[model samples]
Target chain A: MSRSLEPLLTSRYGIEESWKLANAERAGAYEVARQALTTRKPEELREEVKKANIRGRGGAGFPAGVKWGFLNRQDGEQIYLVINADESEPGTFKDRSIMDLDPHRLVEGAIISCFAIDAHVAYIYVRGELAFSVARLEQAIADARQAGYLGERPFGIDHAIEVYVHSGAGAYICGEETALLNSLEGRRGEPRLKPPFPAVKGAFGMPTIVNNVETIASVPDIVQMGGDAWSALGQLPGDGGVRIYGVSGHVKNPGLFEAPVGITMRELIDDYAGGMLGDRPLKAVIPGGSSTPVLDPRRKVDAPNEDHPLHKWHGQSEIDVPMGVDTYRALGTMLGTCCAIVMDDTVNMVEACRNLMRFYKHESCGQCTPCREGTGWLVDVLDNLCNGRGKPDDVDLLVNISNNMMGNTICAFADGTAMPMLGMVQKFREEFMDAAIHGLPDGVRHDDSVRSMVEGVA
Target chain B: MAFALTPEREQQVDDILTRYPERRAALLPVLWLCQRQNGWISPEVVEYVAERLELSTAIVKGVVTFYTMFFDEPVGENVVWVCRTLSCDLRGGKAIQDHLEKKLGCTAGHTSPDGKFTLLKAECLAACGQAPMVQINDYYYENLNVAQLDRIIDAHAAQGGEDAAAEFSTCATFGAPHGSRGGSVTSAPPPPSREAVRLASQPPPANDEKGEGS
Candidate 1:
């Protein structure tokens, strides 16, 4: 298949002067918002989004339209649409690019999303560390409001939409929807229990829809072109639109690429990314953000597609995965946040896990006892293996901790932290054991191994 | 000398307090202010923050301990926050840390013997493309290789560099505030002076129920 237009979704981002809300408005940024206000009913808009088949960009491939459909049409309580801008999922930085390059895109998308959902209040809960993006977004919102695109009586409509930008205080758990709501409500960033997912009872105890930056930003396309047209934008079956994926590590062009969903990994690396940098050979790829299970470049992903629900969910086994949303799911992982972290041959998988452990352990909110302790334990085992002090069954122990931590916590953050650990242990068990045998390679400094081991394993 | 929260600072603290519906929910910002004043969250400052925010000492401690941004232990005169996120990590952040450790005779999490510098490996500071960066005090030195970092450290340690060091002393001095959240330091009021604090302490307006009435 011939490649489509190269810029894709990033076409607007190139024009620096066009980044302003006014320019964007003039260029049809708020056209959808106006359309939602004047032309379509809120329920009709939601239905249209459902037809678009847009999926959540934050790791999970949940249908965006379906997620939005879950929001009850009753408008008694104030509805909220929170933009989860906490893009700290290790390899994920596409959201950052969106917010930084043309925040008005997000503002436009958000306004349209709010209109579609009948939410009068929208909050952009930016990660604590994203100062530039926050400023950019705040400015975009102010500009949008000045142009009557946001705020009370926006887009010449009877309904008013108020936009607020709130900052998270540096915690990864806040990336989780409910956890983000809790943080916005002035609490520590920890995930709230499900059964009352954000759709049911979210920010300030009102029904809310929490969406990733890209997911929300994708709304305008669906609103403008109609859902059917937008649904045909990507590569995956029933996928929608080009994704701005951040591909790093060993890639020649270690940066962001806006590509269709069904694009193959080889195309992403070899064609878009210019292949691996230097002479390093491809070893593995974390197709999504850190949350997805790592896939060995050599091994095929065997995901079976039987008619049974159990088989459909679990029997999905090894296949040569591509970069699309469906392909990622087929590989027992989701095209999460699209933070394609590529690992080359030179990288010691054991050391990489150690690096990842430090992140997981540091970012764990410590809300659940299992996640709080489990991440520490997994990190310790990985640390020992890296420091050449691994025990025989450390591999088994890592898996055990990871297995126990999955789906047992208040939020998916626990599972996010566990997935990488699973990837490390499952895909590179021998590397870890070998490191334990050989010890810290010559110059590798082993600091606090005893401390990390005692604390991590115990 | 132990610095106390000036009335203006206290008002700022109170404003943060009122933003939260729960009176005691403002512990993080209050402790942050206290740490800024006292150069660390000492036992006394934590107590003061706890009292001010209507939170217990342990509760305040828990918040401080949970966040890596809040330093529980005292750091040196200058804190070097190194970004260790994926982009920076790929861009040789580990190598830079090693070099800094060798040059400063301290690892990523330790302070120098002379109480001059404390190196802390931090999460993403959002300057990913410019990897191997360090926020020395308030100023960020980005795109730092070993050579660039050496020049930075050397510039600080050079003779008659105290003035320069003071000018470049904090991450806030970099013009743009660096964080995933604080909306940059531009939004933050400049560090309060002692006299400003004293003047802020005198209560005047009665409509202070809006949290931090000065």
Candidate 2:
């Protein structure tokens, strides 16, 4: 397949050579920038992005045009665009790759987005812990300013747009757009209530549009290519042109790939990721990022009669059950950040849950009471299960705690924290229960591995 | 208690503050500059930032503590921030942590005995494809394992070799260097991509050799 028109591999592209505005201009990158700046009206710019059907690539494949449309136009308040580059989701690192390789693409996209929303300032909220990324973005911002692409009245536009790169203090909650704004404003990173969604009240209590790095990065291309042509690129109903899904664990070619949304897990694993490593059997797949529920390989009963150009659609009946934004949502999980984590038979379900619990516990911002305390409790519970100290009641306790933690916190950080525990209990309740049952189920000794651990050492 | 900004430092602060419409808006960048000057964010220096930004001491204090990058406690002469995210975890970041603790006799989040180094476990350094990575000051060292980590520490120890022998100095208030200027801290160099795989895939000392026998 031709590499042209694909998601640019950030690693392959040199920072100063292929990524910056000057490099893009030299390589015909700003052909669209020039047009968008000089010719296209702001409203037309919005319409074109809408037509391109570029869905947010930071997960929850919301249509970029529609999200931008949500902005409540105020007469005097300045609109802002915040790029969420907090790529802290356990399996999601595609944004990090893009930012590191070609931060300029994001800058260019943010500029176009700012122009569309009538915004004057944009902030890229990177994870505070990522020193290298923050530095890369800092250098890119400096370069953009020098090239007259950013800073006051850039590109001769009457409106002034100053791009700021703010590093978060490592809160997964900050990944939630509103919480990110809170942190940027120098407050504890906590999610704000909706109704004042970022479009209404965001960074510095102004109208803001928080888009994923990949979403804004796609804007330059959409502006270059006609919106309809870009929209046509996504064959699925709400499918977008290209996505950088980071695949990890047990995959042969484990790395980041740019594929259309309709691509199935099987194809991504087989064709793109070069199938399972060492020819091992695939046991489960976390289709989206770490937060999405794990799907059993056996239960992947592909809906009969599904058809989509990009997907492995067999017939028409299965179209409603496709794997992109429309389908993943219908299946009760979002294609959040497209971090496909593969697990083989060798992966113990109890152990996986324990590992995920550890991540959620470590990353929790300790803002809301449920999330702050609930994450650690979940991990402790799972840790007990993994270490074979689990009781039958512990399973219910996990579900109860996770259930309480959902949607009750300041941020969706609570939800990302809760999803894995609920998912493990839902999918592998039997495995957990079997591990929990000790020496004997009915007065007969069972010499199981879990039993030995629970019975105390020999 | 205030760390007075030298005339030149004041000018730099003024330049940055002017860029933002509101003085409070420049809190993050100004604090970053402050940390660079002091090597760590002390309460007194934070109070100084509070006064310079015209923000309440509480506000500056809140901002400084909220962000993880700014260390409240004093660190070693060099800061090595290790990424403990999934990508790094998959490629043996835990092993690197083990090696670091062994080499420096300090666990993650602890400063070395001689105060020559401090190991901090950060979330994501954003270089995932390289897997297991660390950031020394500002540079990213990717595709790391135990040996790569040791080599990095050794190199730093060698460069700041003399400083390692110094006693722990509990720094109090910020001291203005002569000329009303802050210390010029050099940014770390970026890692060469060619060395990623070899550096990341290096096996540990005993276990790797034992596996070779099998």
Candidate 3:
């Protein structure tokens, strides 16, 4: 099927100074917000969103409409809408591009989302590392407010609407919805225990809805093109709309491409990314962000029989699998952030795992024991293996620790930390074992040079 | 020296305080202002922030130490962060680090003897499309090779170096349409000159004060 759909979220990207409010409005920016506020009731907009089936673009693929439906909306209680712009997930840069290039789109989407949920206030929690994105977003909000699209009685509506840009200090844990809440409340960026989810009790003890930048940015387009039409644009049934797939590392054209939901990985790398850099042989691909399990393009499934889900790809490599949430789940990985990190044959997998593990170790919020300790343990073991001091049992030990770390934390941070390690060590067990028995290949730097620079600042 | 926000910065802090419903919620932005006014977040600045927001020093210090961006101790005049993640690593990120260390007369985590530049490693600045990039203060210098690195370092080493480096736009151009294949490097202006490398390596006169805030 031809999955090349017209760009919705990224249409304003290439335009000169698209971040400016004047340029954005000329390209039809806040017309949805204006129309939604004037013509449609909040309930109608919410129902339409529910019908559209837009999933969160931030790692977790939860339905955005379902998430909004969980809001308590108790009388006399304040409701909040937080935009999770903390795009710290390694190999993910799509959200940054949106906030940087088309801030007005996000501003308009936030307005529409708030209007639907009856939330008068919204906060865009952006990562501090993205200073430029923050500046652009802040400017957009200012211009939006000045243009009478924000503040009390926005767009001639009777309700009050306010939007603020909040900057997060460097902490990957803050990307978690609850952790983001805690960070916004001026606490340590640590995840809180569940049962009282954000929809029930969120920021500052209010009913809050946290949506990803891309998820919220998709709202304007969804509202303009009716829910069913937007739903029809996807290659898969429920996976609606086009997703911005970021192709980085060892690609001829390492950039972001807005393609349909069910486009194949081979198409992304070949047609969009212009194939591998220097025509090198593809070794493996992190089909999502670094948190998701790595996928070896050459590995064929060894399913027991035809009844198994893996049977369909029993003898085929995962390179051609259609990219979607359900498809990746069946393949034992996730379509996380849809940002693929491609590795060529010349790259060392062990060192690469160590590099990613180090990031998880440094970013672990100490609230959960497994993530705080297990991430460190994983990094140390991987470091030993990479530096030739590994024991024979280290490979199995890595899997054991990864198994223990899974499903043992307040949030999925530990699981995220463990999944990639398990994926790398288990998928490439022979390579790790070879390195354990006989050190890393010559010319490989053994020094602890990969130590996080954030450590030095701390 | 005692920590205090300048009159203008104090006004900005007041404005920031109005954005959040609670006073403590403004702590992060307030801390950012204090860090910008002064070079890094010292104990005095932490105390000042706590007093300003009615938060305890313990809470303020806990926050300062938790984030990687807030420097507790003094950093160099210019903080250069080179991303060493897997994506950048596959595209010669290590060589960039090695070249930086040699050129700066310092290791990845240390500052130069003259306090001109501090070289540090970063995870990912979300500019992987232009791999092997570095962030000098608030601006990102991407698609860097040895020659490009030299030009950038030399430009920053000279007096009012940031002005000379102003040609490098902070805004990313990677958002261009997919068909155009607009890598960030394509948008970057050509190199200035190789003249400042010697000045950068020699470390002109020592200036204890940090570079101006972003």
Candidate 4:
């Protein structure tokens, strides 16, 4: 279904000068922040956001209002709102567009969110490699400051805001909330232990609110339009606002598709992305980012057949399940980042898994032994199996190792790495077995995808 | 060689410090500013940064090594990142890597002989939708082919470009994803099944059958 009214996050993506301050202001950029800052109470703004059911777009989809409530709310301690622009999750490119095409939207939302949480300052810790995005966002921030949209006392309001943008030195883990805080603090970007969550003690031991790029960029809309209107955009009650989905890999017309959170994968592929690249039969789909499990959409995704207790907790099937956090959780996976990667039959599952494993193995912080060691072991075993010299038990052996690694590390990084392996070993076990017992799966030829380069030319 | 930031850059570093309540917070940005000037974060630069932030050199070194962006050694005049991840892999990222390695006379993470280019195989730069994408300094050359990429690089080399990262924007440099010539052609699809594949799908061979001797 087409989105009613204007697209909240990407309303101006296609327009010329959408990123410039003049165009954004002409299109009503900071009006909500202006009104909210001067006319509305901070708590009222938070309530409106709470009513809108806005959730974190940084993968977890944690309700943003609930997260804002976690701020100590006391008068003395300083509160900080960190924008997670470190969009490193594989297959997820939705946030980059906002940073590139519409930086003012984020600036407006960050200002409104700072008011809601009573945070005087906000830091956007951008990914180091995203120098292009950083440059655009920095220019946007400068323009906003020059216009008095930022800095101490805006438009005669008593409230003050100072915006600063920081760059992350390339670490995937920095996308994690605690790890992001650690990196922002000029330390190693390692995930911190929970219990003293970031809401209570974060970013130099202050009560901080960390949000994803899309999550904060979505705030101004809920404020501009009433909360009920925003929530109605969701596929389900309490489903929050629309999500920015990235459809990539093996799919024709692959790009950003904005829709309600619970839109099914089938619709995303066929209707939005123009189906598979050559209309080939699908092998599998990563419903979310690399951290989430893969879905073998060709078969039933019943709960009882799943390899974890996730189904027992929520109890549902995922074959045609709506793509949302709770629905995915019920299906023994997560709706993280909403970066969908569709695989065609020609792909060798073993090599795909290896490509994914190498990411985790390289990204692990070594803060926990299980993650540091377990990831390396998985890579080694996959190398052996995919490169010849694997025992048949290797697939099952991997399953066993992944099971041990899940929930046993300091952070969810271990589980995030393990879940995909679990998905590959469980759903695409035959392919893994083929690599071990025989060789690459039939029809999967020439390990190097160099043929892609030639085909694009010839 | 002196491991010092220029007066204006030092002011930029000091300004970044005011954003955070602590002095240590400026370490990363300071190091980045240094890299922007020096092309790499050398040992003396690292020590200079450590001194500036009041952090131990070991601590600064640890911080530098932890993040991938801060280079320990000099890079080429331009750094090109060819994505090497699942979506890119499926879209032939490996070929782009091989092509760049061949053209630049350097493998991934190596500078070219003329020091004009440094090629790196990066992990998921978050442009999956534009499969087979490369970030050259600041601008993205997405949905690329060997021919199109060759032209882009040749144009840049002919211009004798410096790092455009600080001033680059998508609206300016993203000329077009692919060049005029070429279609996505493929060899005939592999026949659906094979004899060995069919045999392996049968109930797993009893563990005892293939073991014991080994």
Which candidate number would show the highest DockQ if scored against the true structure?
Answer: 4
Residue lDDT tens for model 2, B162-193: 23212111000001111121211111122121
TM-score of 4: 0.90
**Local accuracy of candidate 4 as per-residue lDDT tens digits, B1-214:** 5678899998888788888899998888898899989988899998899889999999999999999888898888888888888877777788788888889999887899998998987889887876667888756766666776686688667764433322222223221222221111111111122100000001011211211111
Model 1 agreement with the true structure over B72-133: per-residue lDDT tens digits = 78888777777676555655666667777888889888998877778888776644433336
Docking class of 4: acceptable
Rank the candidate models, highest TM-score first: 3, 4, 2, 1
The deviation in Å at residue B109 for candidate 1 is: 3.0
Cα distance off (Å), candidate 2, residue A253: 2.7
- At residue A48, candidate 1 shows an lDDT of 75
Reference contact recovery of candidate 4 = 0.48
Each prediction's total of clashing residue pairs, residues at least 3 apart in sequence or on different chains, is 30, 8, 0, 0
Of 1 and 3, the candidate ranking higher by lDDT = 3
TM-score of 3: 0.91
Give the residue spans of candidate 3 off by over 4 A: A1-4, A301-314, A447-458, B159-165, B170-172, B175-214
Write down the worst ten-residue block by lDDT for model 2 chain A: A449-458
lDDT assessment of candidate 2: 0.65
User: DockQ values for all predictions?
Assistant: 0.07, 0.14, 0.21, 0.24
Distance from true location, Cα of A83 in model 1, Å: 1.1
Q: What is the TM-score, restricted to chain A, for candidate 1?
A: 0.91
TM-score of chain B of 2: 0.73
lDDT string, candidate 3, B57-152, tens digits: 999999989988899999898889988887777666777898899999999889999899988998877777666578888777665656667877
